[model samples]
Target: MKRPSLRTGVRWKISIAIAAVGALVAVALSLVVHNSARVSMLDNSREVQLERLLFAQRMYDSTKEPKLGTKLNDPALPHDLHVKMKQGRRATYVQETASGVPDVWAAVPLSNGTVLSLHSKFADSTTIMKDLDRSLIIGSVSVVFGGCALGVLIGGQLSRRLRKAAAAAGRVAQGNTEVRVGDAVGGVVRDETDELARAVDALTDALNERIEAERRVTADIAHELRTPVTGLLTAAELLPPGRPTELVRDRAQAMRTLVEDVLEVARLDSASERAELQEIALGEFVERRVGVLNPAIKIKVVHESWVNTDPRRLERILGNLLANAAKHGGTPVEVTVEGRVVRVRDHGPGFPEALLREGPSRFRTGATDRAGHGHGLGLTIAAGQARVLGARLTFRNATPEGIEGRDGSGGAIAVLWLPEHAPTTTGSFPILKLPG
Candidate 1:
């Protein structure tokens, strides 16, 4: 059995309820009218019969001889009455007869030894009531069907408008940030759909303005930095090495590193530089990067799992972690990879407790720190890349008890966790399956 929908504004439900109530009331009223008519007709018939009996009594009193009144029964009354009159030689008997149907003949004894009978025919109230009931049923049915159709039409129209508004809102939420829901034609505007459309339009306009402002700022910063950086690179490359200046070489290399880091961070934000998505073995990748870094550290690959991610982006995140560990952390820093989670634990004097709480903030670290880290932008850039690849990066201190840094101080750990994609059980099928 198909169940009825519980949606509000269902015309069929309202129409059925109204028709059922109307039908019941019509039937009740029809019965009342029918009974009332029958009773009234019966009362009128009884009254006329009583009057005839009274007149017969007066006639008998005037004649003074009861024989004339008794003999009146010999011929009986007219055809209007169903009565049998029989002569008993000494008296007469007049009996009214009926067939137990609606049409009945009633006879009553008069005071003067005479009898009067009144003929009553069947009442037509039943026929009138039936006609009335049929009229009510037909009217109710017509109205119900028509009203239901109208309601369905109106409901469908409203639902369509709401669907459009929902689609527009979904786009705005997804960062399209430029979607609009136009006005609906021939529909009520006080509903949720109108409110949603207005909200979507307003939100899209606001997002567009903010995004435009951010784009202008990013572009200006990149251009200002690019000019001097380019000039420095070009001038350094043209200098005569016959002079063989160690200071010049060191400064030039530092400038190049700074420029590369800047460009890499900028590329991370550019939409056109999205990393290629591929399924990569987490254990193998972590081991390879650890081999390359080799920071006199205890590196452990704890997980044997696969993930779908951008390889280049993942490498960049790991590279920054290893560099930070080697610079700030002492020798024998620990590198651990478990599933998609990677932790670069360091055995150095941990970050200043207060500063550790606010770690990775932009420009918080000085350019000429003990480890030569600059402006604290490496972790920030790595965090940006991790976010783009849907990963998380965090910093925390190592075990407080017994564990000491290479410098005989407490140590800190930075952990990075990425999500692993589950394996597909079947190939070349629309339906999804999990690996058993």
Candidate 2:
């Protein structure tokens, strides 16, 4: 099954995270620089204001009244500054004026229990300080925006490399051995993603080698046994007139069947094989398969269904599933057809936990009757043929919880879903023999 793609991809996540941190750092640095610059500007202004206050003090004694931004006990003075000056203290304060612009005030206590005050147009406050604050804010925002862009660029490059590697690995898993990392990552420097690509490449090479070796071995063995198996069957036929002859013929036929199965496996593993597909009514097709197998097996068609598939390979799959159910399961075996899907159910104890978990294997039947019969190749052949038909075959034990099996108490059900959507492949006619 294909894994669901991420909604918020890694690159965007990286971009957002970097932008968030950049925004935080930008805001913090702007606050610090703005605060320090504000304080420094105010201190310099305060020194200049104090000098003007001294000059105003000299003029106060001579003029005896306010002039040139000087005043004596001006009622407009802030109440806090007035209280401080009356208490015999020089005071300076800044407050927003009625015009919404800030002004600086200076006050001095006089010997006659009066206070003298001076005001200066809060010069340089309009231009230098306002400009500084605006510049800081703009600079901080620009840094954050630039950082976010940079993060997106870098993250996109990285994500592309990772995505390429993942896609290549997926292709390799699907048996494409030629895929490689090919030095296709961003930046000159190497990283872990590069290493992952290399690893996938190496893994593909190894898997290809192993599969080729196994296929060659299987084909060679089956080819070698073909002539001998034929000879054995021919020899048994010459003596098949009594009980011993019958047993010999049966054993020889079984051997021939085994050899044919191995050859078919080798052929199925080869890439050159292709399926011959035809359209058929699924319900009628399944009934024919059922009628040929066991008249006792029940058949149910939930809906009228038509499918394009290799009837020969599909027949092999269904035949094996039915034979397996008849051998290992209890009575009342049933075949269900719905759409392009077929299900074979048996009323005995469900499949072995090992088979249910890991699927079928050759020469390893999951169960045995009182006679200890079964070669374990039935489901294995079915699964192989199903793959050729581009179908899904799943086995599950029925339980109270759901149809997907875990408990063995409710019997076993094997579901086969044919995919006419995908191009199916098949082989020559089956060996005309039953599997395990």
Candidate 3:
């Protein structure tokens, strides 16, 4: 089924809700009042009939026969109100008599062994009921009509204002940052619109600022690239036939590294660097990482394992770990690898207590002593890359007996545990298979 459009105005919806509630209340109240009035009228009728019986009894007691009670009938009495007896027994009821007018009759048995009846017309009450019925019908019609009219008026006003805001939002979505939502009507009174308007205006201002900043960055990049490209081209044209022209070679190499780093950062920003997954032998990858750093450190290998991962990201992660260890800790950094797990320990003052809890936050480095060498983006980048690859990285202090202030001054240990592939007992491990 198709969903209802959100473009409908809030005023209309609010009005509809109010109308529905009012209608329900009117129905419920009318039912209660009508029933109550009917019950009261019936009770009053019964009471009047009882009163008439007492009056007739009084007259019968005074006189031997019901002769005085028969004279109780008057010209002004209701046609239906007349004394009557059935088989010498007295009875009372509200019913039409021989004259065909509604009346209340009260009957009594006299002490002299004669039946007597008294009746009174309830014409006023019947007329009052007819008037009340007419008034109720008119009142109900008026209530419904008034509620609908009010609802429609309110709904139209709300819808018109909301439409303006929606149009502003549409312009924003279309990249028109300058489009602003002006002061608009909102709330039951006039309470909420100001805040919403201010928020939208602020958002538009921020977006414009960001767009301007990006434009400046783009201009700067172009300016910076020109000189390097010209230098590279000029050096290539004039081949210096000297013994290992170090200056030209170095400049070219430096330029290449700078360009590559810039491109890589751009790729990272765009989220376009996709991992190429392959079944890699974990033992070899770990061993290769530790060996490449070539730190004069004792490295240990544990549990041979395999995992499916991208080699490029793995190499970069390991490079970051080794570099951080080399910079922060003293010589003899210990490297250990087991099934999808790698740990690097340095005999340097362990990560400061504050930074350890903060994890790899910006500018919070474990190696404050080497702060002059490089800004601290290594751990931050590593943590980010690990998250992208769905892996966990953690750090802790390694308190060996000689590692604190004694011999292994200023050392910290970082443990990286990657998930191990679930075992497949049916096939041989990758490394053990015969060469293809």
Candidate 4:
């Protein structure tokens, strides 16, 4: 199994911590047991040796002989015990390796100027200690393994819960207000994870309610202004054909457009608009729409593709993009259709930093259009309509690739991607060549 990264999540950290603590405890216990066993065995061996040496010394003194019985007459005695016996010490023992074999030698002085020595090999105590050491090693390994296993189990559960909550919050951020963090697993007590989930769910509900209320207010305001706006437009049109009358007409038209755009936005917000999907030839659709608006605009097709979409809404999206380019960009607007993507590019001072950063907003104009006359709802409406059609719309500065006199300078490109299987017809349009 692959080990988890310690830096990435809590799972590995917890597991490692548990294993380390377990290893320390196991080592301490093993050391304590090993030391206690060694001390106890050595003390008992020394006491037995002393008792035998004293009995041998008393027998030698009574019989007036230099040697005692075979039990006390070992020829492999260490020289250190003989030297200690000559110094009048009654009982003495020393550890030694005689003939390469480890043993304890004990001696006692005999009354006939001789010494009695007893030998006890360390093999018995050594064998017992080795067995205990092996057992301790096995036990330590089991402890570490068990601790790590438990830590991984707990940490994995916690990480999964946190991930679910984070994913739900992400959906809410992306305008999915219906998402909620679900309940805990069976038999699992509620903890910080559950609390966080509840908080996110509550936040989503509050946002949904607030947004719905705002949409209702906006729709009501738009409906109420329609009557007055119509009256103003009628009054302006009835005036004489003069500069002042034209100004009044223009302002009235702008007001009407704003009110209509606001109403449309309100409807989209409330989910009142639904897509009516139909099969259509995408390349031909673009060509026809651009021709009606401005024949001078060039159309290029790489791979003609069909798409299933609401034609009215698609038209609105493309219309807004073309209109924005014409109003703000230089001449020669270009539309390219390749597969499921449609890109509208213009030779202009590209999109402003704010628009690219914060996306489109109603009534917010860019630095390029200092007059601020445009209501800034074109791109916003296009984006909203694209969403309704289940498509993605992105705006960016066009790079200098095929265009002449442009060296990676300013230009705006709006790309729209349609679903793959939304085709009604399939035919390729020849690529058009435009003068640089």
**Tens digits of per-residue lDDT for model 1 on 1-436?**
9998767543445555655665666667656766686567556655654455445545666864433123234234443332332221121222334632344334444555555444444445346546766776676566656655665666666667767777766655543443567543225457766776777677777776786666556556756777787787677777777556556667777766765665665554443355467888888887887787674557677768888878888888888877776777666677888878888877666554434454464455622233346656677677766656656676766545335534444566777777554322211011111111
Give candidate 4 regions above 4 Å deviation: 1-10, 57-121, 183-187, 366-373, 400-410, 421-436
Please report the TM-score between candidate 4 and the true structure.
0.79
Model 4 clashes, total count: 3
lDDT for each of the candidates? 0.59, 0.76, 0.61, 0.76
How would you encode candidate 2's per-residue C-alpha lDDT over 297-343 as one tens digit per residue? 88999986889888898899888888888888777898999898898
lDDT of 3 by residue, 382-415 (tens): 6545544445677777563234466554467776
Q: Report each candidate's C-alpha RMSD, comma-separated, in the order given.
A: 14.0, 7.0, 15.8, 6.9
Which residue runs does candidate 2 get wrong by more than 4 Å?
1-8, 50-168, 175-195, 229-252, 302-306, 353-358, 363-375, 400-409, 421-436
Writing each residue's lDDT as its tens digit, candidate 4 over 349-416 gives 66776677777777787774533557788888887777777677777776442344455355788888
TM-score to native of every candidate shown: 0.46, 0.69, 0.43, 0.79
lDDT of 4 at 346: 85
Clashing pairs in 2: 275-426
Prediction 3 global C-alpha lDDT: 0.61
Q: In candidate 4, how many Å is residue 21 off? A: 3.0
